[model samples]
Target: MRKSRIARSGARRPAVATGAAAVAAALLAGGFTAVPAQAATGTDDPAKALHLGPKEKLVPQGTITDADGTVHTRYERTYDGLPVIGGDLVVQQTRDGRVQDVDKATEAPIKVPTTKAKVTPPAARRSAESLAPSAAGGGSPIVQDQAPRKVIWAAGGKPVLAYETVIGGTQPGGAPSELHVVTDATTGRKLADWQAVETGEGNSMYSGRVKVGSVKIGGQWVLRDQDRGNMQVFNMRGGLDEDSAPAFRNAKDVWGNGKPTIAQTAAVDAEYGAAVAWDFYKKVLHRNGIKGNGKAPKLYVHYDNNQANAFWLDSCFCMHYGDGLDNKTPVTSIDIAAHEMTHGVTSATAKLRYTNSESGGLNEATSDILGTAVEFYAKNPKNPGNYLIGEQVNLLGNGQPLRYMDRPSRDAEANRAEGWPPSADYWKPGIGKEDMHFSSGIGNHFFYLLAEGSGKKTINGVHYDSPTYDHKPVTGIGRDAAVKIWYKALTEHMTSTTDYHGARAATLKAARDLYGTKSKQYKAVQRAWDGVNVN
Candidate 1:
């Protein structure tokens, strides 16, 4: 019934209007005049000019208050009471409300023809469900997670009325599925749908006898940490359905004996990884679980037999780990846990789509970058932090790391059948078009060069030989500053559709926000992008 309706509907998508500068200038002297200092200093306060229409509203997504009495608040805009995709922005100012700067996902106008949808809800769900497959074919049961909601599609160079639906299923692989589908409400055409399937830690196995968090439930110890957003780990034991899965329990609160075969071992790793990540965000980055709300999604381990990979799904708002090549090799490690969980962080902040070419690579790289930092922050001697991702798990089965930051090309996709190069040592045009795992090398290499500089060196018993695209020497700004700058750019500036070039601009803006525009730290960010050939 709805299938015939979908086939009949076809309309051209509207183009995004580009007049942000004219709007900004017009608002500079409007009744909502900025403070004297803001006007005198000529700060670009997009928030002051946010009154594009009365129906438009700015809802706060996050706020950062600094020790120097500066405030930065990120907001998501709603058009005609409908969520406006790609309509998020951040406003920064002094304590006295003197505007400093603003960052937005898009500068396009938000007006549309109307809020009514020609495509009915049932029609949209049918269209989205048609894209999903059977359970055996890597899809969920024929059940809608929720009713499809109307939204404004603005990321694809235009703003159009649409329907956003969450489909229930696993991707082609047996990972939890949260395939977000955006359907044109007028034409019934599918605009975009993303399944973040492509890609933790902890363990007594990897981190080695690490401290874990547990809570008492009905006088019995259950593997749940109340501090880190009440993160609870469930043992799948080669099953699905987390609601029925049992949580690892202990009478004395001693979780694992440090054995991979033991189910509790993976639980310990998951708990430890969550703790370290929570601590890392709070202490180093000054961030909480999601938007500082202290709410982390559930974590499920041993998801499927020989699952071999881990994934974060928006449907369950949870992270799932696999039993790896063999049942004995659970893929839970500190960096791995941090890596998967950072997917959650990226979703909550930048909302970077895992399907887009460039955004997907950045999404993966963001996880790798932050995951590496989490490992280094743990100070766990058994699992020392390094630029190499998944070194403890050794997924390659050759005692080699999954992906190398200092030298990404070292582990390119050897299987030409996969249709991607080994890896890229430096950024090149269309690098985003490469496999997200390998394309992520561009970001990884840039970060490595920025933190350690371009040269051969040894740290923590691991050797690194980082190079640059221009073959010029790029000075190290230290990982401490690099991580800070990256986290800032990700949370405050980046958008869902941000590409490599956009990343260059976002990080530079972040550096200017943190250190002065003239500071050496700012220069390091510019040089780092240049080293990656992003310029």
Candidate 2:
């Protein structure tokens, strides 16, 4: 029997690789073309380089200017006047407007038949309802109509014309489920179904008596932030519907008593978490907000009846948190909040698929990486920055962290003893059976090795003994440099379908861009991935 992998501590494990020459192939598949850092002579319009014609329209989304003066302009594509879901691409150019390279999600020619849907909206809704799992406790299921879009479903041989229908409703456990169901436009056959909600947990019990933002309206203080996009925290009061939850109110700006008994206390932690996350992104990453548009996502705390999970819903562009175990333990820690919110960042940028084994693992790991960076950025005394994830929640009864980045194998051993599947340390056969949370160990381990190096070391008073698959030791590049490389890789290099091998290439490219190709940081990134057996 395969060994069960378990995390050593924390309330819940954060749910969430490849080769060299083969790595180049994966990068090319993701639409990345690495060009040498040299100025192009011509004054070619970057937009014109897209070669968009009358049948195809390109809508400018955003522009990212790298440290090397390379400008990356992103665009959303439309073919035949219909929005293409995966038809987004980025045009890279020099400061002189000379085209450098282009990275796209799909290169398949969008040559589908008539955009008119043969299947009625009602028919698509019924087809979606038939596939949705029943809610727990026999609660009547509610489904919302999502705007249908013309998309190219390319999973099967050739890209085919499809109508994408989204069905959003409550799950059996009171968790929100947003199902993306794709149906053939002509045949009405269900092509694919993917859940949009990414579920995890956060326990407010860890962050004790943190300060929260509030505004005094009329006579009472409410959980509204005058700063940070005026993001407000709402109290579900054990309810499931977010639309009905009332905004948390207080007599004074000071909130929470460092105890779970008071719902307001959890609200304080949740708001503080949001504020910290917002500040981290803006101050460190230069991102204005989660969407990079100076907008804050609505935060809902105390959701459902002891839901014991937290999730980021792309449909609502909101973050929802659940109360764990008897509605007392609210999942609202600093790392958890940052982790869930980072999902939004991932969606906005790479839009990595949360279902594909390798891509899903990358998606989860991006959250962990950014979330950890947020913790260190905050540097709160109550929750000092550490390599351990979800340490404050104490989800395992024992005072252990959910997952140890310094030594992910520790969680694998715990998982094995607990009869859980083995964590994916180095990719092996049957790895798909491992939970995304477990497969994330490989990434967590890789980052740790990259930032802190391999072998025995103590960070923030915690001992870590990391190992390499080839029994080779690696030197550290410091977390600061490591984070910049990772952030650039995620935003500028990687795409939705990028897997482990692709990640290896992306980070290397990021490093080369930031520090010259022959820099120690670039070499360190290679060594770190090698330590994780990604080479």
Candidate 3:
């Protein structure tokens, strides 16, 4: 069956007769959608077991229309040992009052604040350079504040105490977004103060502090940290599910002009990529895991109709992958997953801005760097790790990879040319039309030079070398040193407005700070810039 996009409308309430009991009765009555008597019982199909016990009732009623135009009236019930309320237990019913697919809904539960995990080797916090408007005495001041203490519950876990805050909001010019501040209460140290866009989906969409904080906006409250688990998987056009779960349907051809289906081949690549990312954080960065909270990583696939893009939506706390339209293919490859998830780690740590050219490029490059690293780490047979982007999605249909990190201009849209001022190259304003993901080529190329270690290098039969702006050989930096430098620059020193030139300078300084100015890593930072053609 085809899934339908849900439409939301303004809400109305009914008049109630009286006291607590009457209020409870009225609330429950208003909660669920009215289901026909026949639909309340079992149907011939086992999947249509849609009934709620009298004692199990919590809501008065509610209903959601599924993709197929079928009405699913959901009610409070006990399914799988978990309490089902509100939109949590939906049952599809036909006009004739017969139930359709009635399985325990897997839409995750709302997170409660609670945790025992201590903040691991804490990360350094860097102040954001004041937005121009704020400095000019225009918008709200974007200030860095410490996280506050509060209680929260981790998904599938008990409540725990944690720290959180709204670091900066509505810069002096009143920028449309706010920077959420999160940290470890026990240590009372800042962890991350990052930007977040409101989803407009009401408090329920976001699991924790945002909801509570919204209750008393102008006033302050201690925010409790809720652990958003790592590893989110979605049933896209083609996805796998347990035997008893409802298989996603109405598979369509989004990319490759072929029906989207989970091939064993693609599955192997995804699994390997996810595993490698998990390991990289554990081994290389010594991160407890994604989000530094030791939670399982999450993977979401098959998003949007004929959509050819992927992004990490900070509001949702998960990575999203999309099947390409006519011009692109499904981006459910392993490297893609690793790349998207790394954005989350960055958000939880550095919180890089997606706007402006340099930050935009860094956003894309971070994913690419880690994506390639994860690929190399996995060494999958179907998709051998390489410095290529979207190799498996086959968007080009000619079996060519998308975006060459060593030379981002390969895509035409990903113009990697530098030397232009930030506005000329960075702020095109449209979302990805010619924005962050595309202009990111410059930084991506820079990273490739930094990683592959300054020169023409070939892997798995693909050969390429770094080029300078004047079409000459740019030289500087070793791969190992470049990684260290960039990572330090990103997590320790760089800010949202930091541009490519700023990045070069910051990494140079970070190298000197981490290793003496005469060290190999220090020189590597300089060489990496030379190799990327950056003066």
Candidate 4:
């Protein structure tokens, strides 16, 4: 199902919330960005979940159509006939008709002295452009194009008549940005100001016998990717910080001896992984680089002594790899490298938290999904791609993969001693409550089900048996299609608070956008979620 790309602004709305009811209490606690409400009852006349007083009016502002064809209508509120500044709210309903009252403000109704603005609109516009934030938000100001809009500033503690100004500008990195400033109508004083543009930064190794970028520095060939973001691999022997761990520089162009004894061996792996991962994002996914910026991030290898792990640090905007037990094996395999780097991508895109039940699992699962995609995209004959995480590292020293997507529970007994609980093969209530690495099975299973479909299959010599929760058969739409849908959802649709259900909706929406709502791929997404019991 291919549909013409059509963009429609503005909206149509009917009062209602869909899904579950407990979300009402959770919303008040800020537990969810959007929740399944009570729209399960009726579609024609959805129940008004938002209990607005008679004096208040809900003015529709914008709308978003989800992949499942559910309309999320955004609205602004007015009290006593005056618009409430920052009183933006959204009524989100999923395909199943689960609706919820989603809004930023959960405080009591606001009361302003009057709707009259003492400060003239022209004066407000002038101040909006001239008033540089007390602290630089890091940008040269662009002139505000529109006039200051009059509204009641009830978003803050107390309601006050005010003028809201939208100031345009470019961020330090030249990304277009907007600064929203709210000023008190009575006085010209700035009440609040914030940058509306968001930017995130964060980047990886193991590959079997691979090609890497090198640079000539002081007559020495350094492990730096001059071609791709200058991604350098540093030797973090034991100390922390880049100061102690200088980058690997070889007197000759040749690097590594294919043995763990040679320090450059691990560096070779890390550097190659970084180069491949970088190319994977740039060529395969069409992402320029991590954070979608062309600049490459730093890489730290041989992280801690005998520390069998690897990770990405968004703060340092670098990827770190550790040596396995006895410091003989480095955890810088292709999948490991792509996996850690994908963490940074997740940070930059959805900004998913590293903690929490559902979101945390999603944050980790995202890395695994994209990492596998990068591995497959690389098409390395030596390291053929498989639906396995950390397959090359041998973390348990048993030749067993870290987490198995087809049947996540397979790694249970092997990794159990490492404090990993048995992973769920399918979604169940509280599945996300497990360790993220294990809980991620729900998403992992969904992806596998989407990419390869259910039951027995073999790819790259790796056999897998994936089962459906309801014992129903699922037909795959192709690995490429599944990867595309997941990527689109993660970058464009997913948010920080997205849970398994939300993830399903986001992917469905992505599939619909890419293949149309009625396409086999769209139906595959639904079937995949059903296989995982997400719906």
Candidate 5:
């Protein structure tokens, strides 16, 4: 047997690189010449350059006539304006075969054009004055025959676009929400009018863009408005948002045979888990939820065959569960659901890319931390949950759990026996898969210290405590403060390459930022990290 991988393997695992960037660079490398920064000027043609400031009051030039009196030429700037910082000029311009005439000019800004330039074929006429500040740069441009669409508002200030969206209504089959709010990047606040199109044919429908920002409902990056958010042609594949396949779905009737259906059972588990996560984050840690968007969550269950795995596909904006064993067992157990969904939370914030050794482990550890916190939140009797993974699944018929945070290596295959030494592999980058499932023990151990308050304490009938790498009996910060510190650290401070040590520093910094630098929470995080040998 493959020694039973972590039941919630997908929870908080680091993201894997699919080599997409390299492929894009390769494709664009051929026959590509860099466009010069500046362009030349011509008669009847106004000088154009990328401006670093706000909109300029320039009455653009019209088409140029040829010898036969037929119009043979037209031109427009690539963009209305460029980025501005302080009072520095950073505009790029191109010139065609026209007479350079600064003296004979149309209505343009007071700034002088740059000396350098490039020339191109005649094109469309432009009347736009100055470009807005928010419309600057992003991914590389695709220079094709057809130009992309541009939406501009005339308020020297940028405009926000609102929309009439129908979300999950009072009734399951009722009209969805009629109003959705998304801000225009150009305009910093909410939109004045709804701009999104009405989309979707049924319950599995919505309209908008899946973006990385705060949502009214509170989940991070689930969805936002189409405007301002980068429109990636590739995002529709598993994207979530106000305009995505509903992330939350009833997992009933998942099994075709209708054997031992746990639809409602699983639904209750998922809801309860989500509720616990929300409460734990709010009441305890002061966090909202995955990315702290404070948005109502969306979930999905009963995914694929009798798959024995559950995961939070961040791109999909939903939690997926597997029907275990003979299809009677739904992996929608509270811990499993909480564990998987936490991955979304982690990704939206820390986004610790799953590749690399310790990064994967950190990802898994994040799920473990939040999962345990949720279980502790529920405090159910029959379900009597704790920090152990897969205890409810009975995946291990012998009553042995998939992982024991108190002492992870006891699971046999984890290879994380107590007192293991930290090495370079633990710090490598892009070692996603291996670090997630196996090396997660380190993070698990840190959580045990933070939650249970380390040093020879027995948790739920298991007598255990992890000693620091220095073989010292380490103390812990109470679970309450630990959860908050970890959350703040992940969301506000940590980056994709952060690891155990980085996590420790981030938690300490977050604690300091949230509470006072000398507050108990900050000290607790510092002590906790020190106990784990991260200080």
Candidate 6:
């Protein structure tokens, strides 16, 4: 959910298709692998009942029961007792055990032998290092154990015996790197490699010097919340290296002076954002934390020199923020904080691929939706909840917000006439070329229409003019109900490869589960999708 610069063009490009093709090519070239598929006609446990092809065994990972009593079961695939790296799928079934849908990452069969590989572990390590020299740091690659597994070589090609090697080191750009290299075990030929690092970026006492949880350890007041599972915030002090950053401590619990001149100001903001986000999920959604396991993620503020972005790194299991615009504006606003952490939630739950168009767009939209929800939940007087994202941060430097959910097209800088990107009004073929941030407008616009309806309106002293692609007005379902439907769809209905159409179906199912099939909310969900032209 990293927001990059927007592409200002009306050209129609198939970025998603092209990116998917690139991913497939990477898989064949030994860069990344695909999961296996499971098709079950009977029983609730698809992992036990589904036919996963020769020598393959599916292990149930997790199960989510929808409001309507339907079950979505996730499974990990293995071949001949060896774990398959990318072989995972979800099976949907009704309360009576009737199978409704089977969402699989790959449908290929795995029939590879699990016998000891002909190639030595040293040789496999050398092969992986050769494939990713940047990960070796011009020295010996810290390769982990080589596990034998079955992986799909091509789109429909038969599964082959491969050695999955884990290489750990630092990349050339100084970022921590962990590469998963797949090599043909019999021939020692490299198949694919993928970076496991999930990069993301945050702010200050911008929430108006609010009370933060702190503890006095060794007579020093530390930014550690003992109440919230000892969650701690560290001050990077404009440093790029995270390992060396120190925690912000003060003589008294009071921190920040409403300005970035004081380092604790940003830490105060970050700590506050984390606290609110944690409470929002716990209280509003009944989820414990980002991973829903009652554990807190590391928070680091003032990362890098004048860094203008905030990111969440899976490798560190933490969130980092950069000071934007002369190192004064911190990106740690409540919505932005919630947005970045939501990426972590998405990673733990759906595990959606960030490169695929539809899934990637959905991924970004999910963050925006939940982040906005967090803002509404907080109701901070200094930073009141609104449809505008990063409004207080002034990321653009012109005082305009980073994005506007109520009117997504209004984000288009060049085409101010229509207030939207030229090709984003409808979900047609090839709209994927639009940046994930921009393509996200499609979903954002849909949510706005669903929650507030179409046309012009003003809320919280903010003006918004929204329009439908088909000129069909949608009835408002209110943000609270809409968010519940979305959360259900995201946590219970969505899979790894869900696209816009999949999202529409998932939301409809969520609505049916929550409000019944014939309820107004169910119909509103459909109308909202239609308004965005997702249907």
Per model, state how many residue pairs clash.
12, 20, 45, 20, 43, 22
RMSD of each: 8.1, 8.0, 22.7, 15.3, 20.3, 8.4
lDDT of 4 by residue, 1-535 (tens): 0000111111111112211132232222221123233332234322234655555655443344555666554444566666665454555556665664343332456566666778898998777766743312434465454567776676455778777675554333222234557788899888765433222111112356667789898888888888897888889785444567888888998899887888899888887877788888888777767766676778877765555666665545676666665678777777777877887777655555454267667877888888888788878887888998766555556877777889888988886776657776777787756656677888888999999999998898999999899999999988888988998787656655567888898898778778999999999999999998899
Order candidates by TM-score, high to low: 1, 2, 6, 4, 5, 3
Highest lDDT scorer: 1
For all predicted structures, in order, the TM-scores are: 0.85, 0.84, 0.49, 0.65, 0.50, 0.78
lDDT of 3 by residue, 1-535 (tens): 0001121111111121322244244334432344443343444422233333322232323343433455545333322222221123334465556655442322333333323435431221222222222322243433333422232212112222333333332322111233444444345443333334211100000001111101112343211112323232334443212122221222231111123344222222333345567776667655555554466444444544454545454544544344555413445556666776677665543445554335555666677777677766655555566777765555434555556777666655322232222212122233233345556666777777666644587877778765655444444454555666676565544544455666777677667766878987676666656655455
lDDT of 6 by residue, 300-365 (tens): 888766566776766567887777647887768888788888888877666554542666677778
Off by over 4 Å in 3: 1-232, 236-272, 326-329, 413-434, 453-455, 470-478, 531-535
Highest TM-score model number: 1
Query: Which stretches of model 4 miss by more than 4 angstroms?
Result: 1-206
lDDT of 1 by residue, 390-500 (tens): 776655456666678998887755324334467677767777666566677888887887788888999899998887878888898899999988888888778777888
The stretch of ten residues in a row with the least summed lDDT in candidate 2 is 1-10
- Candidate 3 yields a Cα-based lDDT of 0.44
lDDT of 2 at 327: 77
Q: In terms of TM-score, how similar is model 6 to the real structure?
A: 0.78
Model 5 lDDT per residue over 1-535, tens place? 0111211111122122122232223222211122222322332223333231333322221222222332211121212332110111111122334332211111223332331112111111011101111111111111112221222221112221111111111101111111111223332332222101111010000111111212234432322222222111111112212243343222331212222343433333444455556666667665555444454445544433344555554433555444554445655555666676677665554446443245557777787778778877767654555667666455535655666776665666432342223221122233333435556766777767666655576665656755555555545656776777677566545554565766776676667656778876666666555655565
Off by over 4 Å in 6: 1-48, 65-71, 80-87, 92-102, 106-205, 414-423
Provide the lDDT at 493 for model 6: 64
